[model samples]
Target: MKLASFRSSIESEIRLGIIVDDVIIDMESWGIEHDLDLPSTMLEFIDLGPAAVKAVSETLKNIDARSLVATSIPLSSAIITAPIPAPRKNIFGIGLNYTEHVAESARTLDTSKELPQQCVIFSKPPTTVIGPGDSIKHNDQVTKQMDWEGELAVIMGKKATHVSKENALDYVFGYTIINDISARDCRRSGQWIVSKGQDTFAPMGPYVITTDELTDPHNLQIITKVNGVEKQNGNTKFMLFNVNDIIEDISEVISLEAGDIIATGTPAGVGAGREPQEFMWPGDVVEITIDKLGTLKNYIVKA
Candidate 1:
């Protein structure tokens, strides 16, 4: 099922919605009309787990637009928000997890680092996340070297601890697109927290697809475009450590609760990794798309 968080122009309230082709079913108002209490926010819906999903599924299956009394509207008329607009915790990220991207980033230094023997992880503050069509902050004085990292992000459905690669996929709720927008200049020293956690750096969503919708998470065509030009064209199949490995590795240390986000690493074609180097400027548009998951697009604007 394709799910979303959106605000209706009439009510102007953030609410949970389920997508059905060209229209979005407003769950919050629908519950009031039908007298069936439903989740109002994406996080609440996720926290409710399978039951919430089942309820929405059943509603969609039985719902007939021709005789409906629920609040349904065209998708184009709603203001879409990140599937998980405000996460409970900072977003977790995997860095240098892609062999090709690792190789490109390693060229600037003489560290002679081989392929990572273990998972390299980092976190981005929740404040960094914005929905698709939102504007990315380009603070010229703060960070002149802004770049984009298109990635497929995973959303956890259950509380996971010490899980194995074999069962990691079972814990996933769904997937979405994330433009891991970066401030290269903020890579001050070797830490990536601040560099990647700046406000409006994580432009995610289009909508979250339930795990059942995607046939294979590990094998999807992921692409990134800057101002209508494709710059990074790669597949998820090339990742050095796939999604299963990422889940197991993190869970081994701490529990991953429901509603948590995990952004799988990006491919090799980042601006900073280019020979002459490239960076985003004001008014530039960045878009990221993963098969099954919808495309996430955002524009750069002066902070």
Candidate 2:
């Protein structure tokens, strides 16, 4: 099921809900209807695991659309906070999982530094995460070349360590869309922290979709459009290192807890790879869509 976070108005508290068709079924309301004690905070639900998800699924199945409150809230209701508003740890992201992206990034530097036998991992601070429809703060003074990397992010369902490729996907709770926004200049400085961890750089979720509904994770199409122009387009089938390998590689080192997100990297056609280079500017709207996982759109504004 598609899960989302939304606020009715600026004065309203952020709420977690499941998106059924065009309607937002508030989790709290569902909890009240079913007599289940709902999570008071977003962080609490992240730890709720399968039981919470099952409860949500069952609740949605029983609710009648006519009986629910249909307030007609706009997509930009108030602010869409990250589905997991505050994760316990920083998010783990992979770089150059798509072969074309690897080749494009390699040309600027040494070609020898191209492909790795293993997944190249990096971390984005939890603070950088924002929800779909949120504005991406473009700090002009620090970065003139801001780019968007549309990726399919895997959300871990259970704690995992030393997981094998066969059992890696079994541990996945769901999937979501992540726009791995980057500052090209900061990234070229040898350290990725500043380039990736800027505030509001990471745009994740309109909802987290459970794995049961998404049967074939590798067969989805991923696309990114900037200001209505299609830019990045590719499928998960092209990934150099698939999802299972990534889990095995990372699990060998650090233990992945529930709610920890793993961004599986983006495809080719980044701004930096263009002929003259086309980067994000103020007022640019980036829309990222992954088949089955719904679309996530965000606007870029001057910091």
Candidate 3:
């Protein structure tokens, strides 16, 4: 099911919903009307693990079209928010995990040309996250070289520590799209916190698609466009380190909690990697799309 966190255009309260085609079935309203004990928010629902999935499944099965229309909000009219608006901790990011991206980084930026033997990890603070249709701050004072990296983000369902690659996927709650926006010049001291962790740097959501729906995460297509011009076009199959490798590698060192997000690296064709380096400017719009996972669109605005 396509699960989402959204707000009604007429209200400020954030609510969870299930997307059926273009309409959003307000889970909170449905639960209340049916007397089902459903969690109020996406985070709470994720923490419930399989039980929550089961509950939602049952809800989908029992919900009829007439009832759906009465309680549902038009997805086009709702304000889609980040699947986890305020993450419990920084989001885990993988760097140079795509062979072509590694090569591009080596040519345009100060990144290693050699492929990583293990996952290269970094963290993006929760403040960096914004939902679909939001704006990405192009603060010239902060960064003159603003770039985009389209990636697949993983959402964990439960706590996982020292999990094996074979079992790593068992902890996943769902998958979502993330535009890992970066400030190319801010990789000072070879660190990304200042470069990639700025507010509005991460454009995520549209909604989260549960694991059962998208069984093969690595086979999806990831594309990014700037102002309607295609900039980055690649596929998840190009990932140097797959999702399982990333989860197992990270879990060996740090515990991954429920609702924790991991941006599983991006494919090639970043602006910085072009023949003449390209960057986003105020008024620019970026749209990232991944197969199975819907497109996430954001506008670049002056900060």
Clashes of each: 0, 0, 0
Model number with the top TM-score: 3
Tens digit per residue, CA lDDT, model 1, 1-303: 998999887468788888888888887777666567887888887788877677767766777665243578889988998888889998999888778788878885222358988888899999999998999999998888899999999999999999999999989988999888888878856888878999999999989998767747988888999999988988999988899999999999989999999999899899988888889999999988888887999999999
Q: Write the per-residue lDDT of candidate 3 for residues 1-303, one digit (tens) a residue.
A: 899999987467888988988899888777777777777799988988977787778768777778777778898888899888899899999999889899999998977889899999999999999998888988898899999999999999999999999998999999999999999999988988899999999889988999878778889999899999998888888888899999999999999999999999988889899989999999999999999888999999999
What are the per-residue Cα lDDT tens digits for candidate 2 across 1-303? Answer: 876777876688888776667666666666776678887455566578878777767766787755466423434443566788667789999987888888877765233345778888899998899988789999899999899999999989889899999999988888989999988888654667788889998999877788767756898899999999999999998888888889989999999988899999999989987777889999999999999887899999999
> Which candidate model has the greater lDDT, 1 or 2?
1
CA-lDDT, candidates in order: 0.86, 0.82, 0.90
Over the full model, what C-alpha lDDT does candidate 1 score relative to the true structure?
0.86
Positional deviation of residue 11's Cα in model 2 after best superposition, in angstroms: 1.3
TM-score for each candidate, following the candidate numbering = 0.94, 0.92, 0.97
Candidate 3 global TM-score: 0.97
Clashing pairs in 2: none
Native-to-model Cα distance after best TM-score fit, residue 239 in candidate 1, in Å: 1.3
